[model samples]
Target: MPKKKSTFFNSVRFRIMAIMIVLGIVPSLVIAKAVIHSYEKRAVSLRISNVRNQCDILCNQLVGVGYLENPSSKVIERQLEVLSNVYSGRILVINHSFKIIKDTYGLDEGKTVIAADVIRCLQGEVTSDYNKKNKYIELTVPIKDPEQQEQQGVMLISISTGEIASSVELLERNGMFFWAIIAVAVVLISYMASRVLVKPFNKITKAIEEITDGYQKEDILVEDYTETELITDAFNKMLNRMKILDESRQEFVSNVSHELKTPMTSMKVLADSLVGQQGVPEELYQEFLQDITMEIDRENKIITDLLSLVKLDKKASDLRVEHLHIDDLLELILKRLRPIADKRNIDLILDCFRPVEADVDEVKFTLAISNLVENGIKYNVDDGWVRVSLDADHKYFYVMVADSGMGIPEESLERIFERFYRVDKSHSREIGGTGLGLSIARSSVLMHHGTLNVSSKEEEGTTFTVRIPLSYIP
Candidate 1:
């Protein structure tokens, strides 16, 4: 038994399923990441705006109450502390001299704190910076003297982004769980869809298998897809062709048996007559011997024709192709068969339209054309004409043999090329025909990758046309 293929990885179903899974999962991951990052950004912006507004209000109060110079106000200190605690951050109030007047954490109150953000704020610029890695939003808000409209101090604050981080982490966990469910659903759906899509092919395979095992003889129909329909149609055509070939083979064998036996039976009867006689006359003996010899010759002709057919049935590679003048070839063929035509007083004629050359197997091509020409002559009326014509074009040359003879019946025309098939069996036998001439001729033309076609009408005439390419293809 042949080794079975890996069911999942090696199959079309697996590839389709894998593509679906990737399609389903990749986009989900991208959208989830984008949503989470957007949330983090929005939350940070809102937190920064809220804290900055509160700082602005406090700085206005400090300027109005003269608290920067006083350094001690119960209301201002309480408000600053409440703002710091609300956002989980630290605040620093700096004077014009860059001294920390009040630190919400109470650690840097006596220190001289000089930072880039603090200096920028004192120059009347409000600035904010976000540190994603540190998870904080830093801001610097300027405090100004209202009457002079000049900078007095700066309020610098750093707010923690711990809440945003926690929210993002939670969203990520939920998204992962949701994506897992969707991934499972997609895999299941894709697997089933793949199987459904491939079902028709499986049916076609099963139908072929049943035919191979001799369990079924009917043609298959798979219309699930256009492709499947096309495949089924092609297979049916091939199956029908095989059936026809098989029937032809059987018919050919049966005809061979009957034809071979007829000559043998005739010879046996002639021989038995002489043997059973006590005193046979010398003239009578000669006649019996002559009859016996005639039967033997007929049998030999049948065998020879059969052998020729068998060789023609062999591969085309057996042909020894050569370049030859087609007009000259036809003339030579007609020359050889002129005596036979003359015996019946049939006017044998050859008409060449133009000089032509072609690649052909010289012996096989000659045999095929010779058979056609001979048939024209043998089946012609006494004193009637048989015309053999040769014509050529750029790519192909044509040979046509037309005879004014007893034409074939329309019904028998189709089967004329079948081995041992005869239009008129009695007439064919009288003319020493083995009924294999047309079949051999056709096979020879086919071997050279050419075509032989015949057209006829009863009691009128018959014409055989052979078309061969100027250059042999294979």
Candidate 2:
């Protein structure tokens, strides 16, 4: 017994959905990281700019109020406290001598400044630092004495990066949540798409399974699936071919049964006539024996033809191929069959195209041609004519045999080469013809990689044409 097939995850729909999920997740995560990074950088830069502008405004105000000569620490401290409260950032004032004069947090009132941005500001230049020990945007703006037109000191500002970092972390968390939602949506959409895409294939698979279970006529029905039309077309073509093969198989069985039954019936009748208790005369016994012998020969011929067909089917590739003159070969075959033709008063004629040659197996090629010639003679009226001719072109060699015989019906011409198909059953049996002759002839011609065709009209005549490719010569 065959094992049952497993269905868990065995469908194309599931596999396609899995593949899409795996391929889409990584790139989405990378894009989310980049977006978060860009937002954080912009936030930090904006905070730094705002703090710098506030410090510039305070320095200008102090100079305008005539407090630059030696501004008291308490007055500077008051200004710094108001600005720091408004901007939410630390403020520091450093003098030209690099001394901290005022600080909003009041951490260093008399200490010398060592910060890089403060040192540059004391030298009459504006500077800023982003990466500093204070984790802030540190900036310095030069303080000029308005009446002297010279720098008296610099104002330093430090804005904390904590707000930027906090916003960035929040945005990143929200982005993660959004990405999770997107991933789930993607998987659901992929699963839906895969289900739609594989629906037709599932139908086809079911049809095939039905065929496997002996429902040979089942068909896959799909509508308007343009994307998979090629697959559908190929599958339909294969099924059509299988249908033809099945029909041929049934016909073969029928033909074999009929062919075997006829001879067995004949033998049984002849045996009964000879062995019946009514005493038989010597002359009648001889006739009954002859009848039995004929039937036995007919049975043997059928079996021989069947065995030959089997061998040809199996060993066609093993035939010996060689270059031989077709004219000489035909002449030899005709000479051998001439005695039979003479006995029937049939006129045998040959129209030889000189030096016609082809690549073919000698024995098989002769057998095919001999069968055609014999068929012509066997079917012809006494003293009727049979003509054999050779025609050739650059690419092909043709052997045609025409006989003035009881020609086949137009409808039966095509099936004449089918095993056990006889157009004139009574005539065939009268002439001791086993219906396998044309079938064997066709198979032999096919073994040489050639074609054999017949044309006939009732009561007129029949012509058999055999074409062999010249280039196929060894």
Candidate 3:
């Protein structure tokens, strides 16, 4: 099978750059087109206005001298010369008969003009139009004799309009240059902005990579990054969670190894004793068999505890729920653990203040409460007291088991409910505890959406409180 190649344009950086180009380029082109069109229109209108004004002034000068019928050619030539010098183009004056009366370029004298605009002006309509053939603007103003109250002849003026085209071309060139500068500046700014945006993401990625490589102790530090603080905070929180989970995994492995080793070591010792060279006595062999049986029993307890913990981690919907009287349940659990209490010489006291009821899985709840009561009696001093009490608040029932035995340290209090965690490892093993008692108890309580908490002071006593909410009860 061949590997597929990824397209570079699919990357985020490429997409961002593409967006900037589209946003920057389209508007620049539109603005350039508009500016060129506006400048061209204004230039043509101003040139035509200037030529019309000049022709009107020349006609007025001729009429004032009463020489409108046969104006001197020298006079018209002088007027055309003045206008041509003021404007940057040639000017021509023609009559209503389309005959050239005066020419600033000195080439149209006594010539009959056959232009469309000139023919229109000869019909007595005022005209200001462009001649595309010669690139000139032609304007015609009607000459009137005030004494006769009638129209005389047309005063036509023509000027080159190529200057308007040149001005529009210059504007377009400048617009292109300005947009080029803007594009360069925008590209630089986009690059800098993308870098600033991706910096925090890079830091997060590097931190994750370090974690994958088993370097999880480092904390993420990004400065001057207020815009990405939320993302950074979430990343840091995930890292902290992973660190805690890693520690938990290591502790579970260590605890399992220790639990398994004790039983296997005992089995090995017993088997060796039974097969020793000194022919094994029957009674001693029975003792060895009893030891093996006890170790097997311990292993069975550890396996049972592990299975219960797994079940508790599953969804509550999987467990069969039923309504049971809290007082009745406690009575049954204490009765079942009474023999252990008797063997240890510990007094199991029950203080029931209310007949509280809750809905929960009966078998799991019984096992959890049994473990707590048994632990209280098993670890207590001779004649020590284990108190089981029940109380109810507005929305929950509280079951508290307090024992006057070797109490836990304040620092280790929270970790007591962790799997296979024991305050005194040697003492727990001597008492035949699988060290998963409190963990199972906590999980069972959580299945009912309840909370399990413990408070203890070393050498004083320990109190385990289980609060079950009424909402969780059917």
- Assess every candidate by TM-score: 0.85, 0.83, 0.72
Q: Candidate 3 residues 376-411, lDDT tens each?
A: 887788889999999998899888999998888778
TM-score for model 2? 0.83
Q: Which candidate is the best by lDDT?
A: 1
lDDT of 3 at 177: 91
Candidate 2 lDDT, tens digit per residue, 234-320?
777888888889999899888888888998998898888778748788899898889888888988888987877766666666788
Residue pair clashes in candidate 2 = none
Ranking under lDDT, best-scoring first?
1, 2, 3
Over 4 Å off in model 3, which ranges? 1-15, 34-38, 65-233, 315-317, 344-349, 383-385, 404-415, 456-461
Whole-model Cα lDDT of every candidate shown, in order: 0.90, 0.81, 0.78
The lDDT, on a scale of 0 to 1, for candidate 1 is: 0.90
lDDT of 2: 0.81
> Candidate 1 residues 365-435, lDDT tens each?
98899889888888878999999898988888999999999898999999999888887878788888888
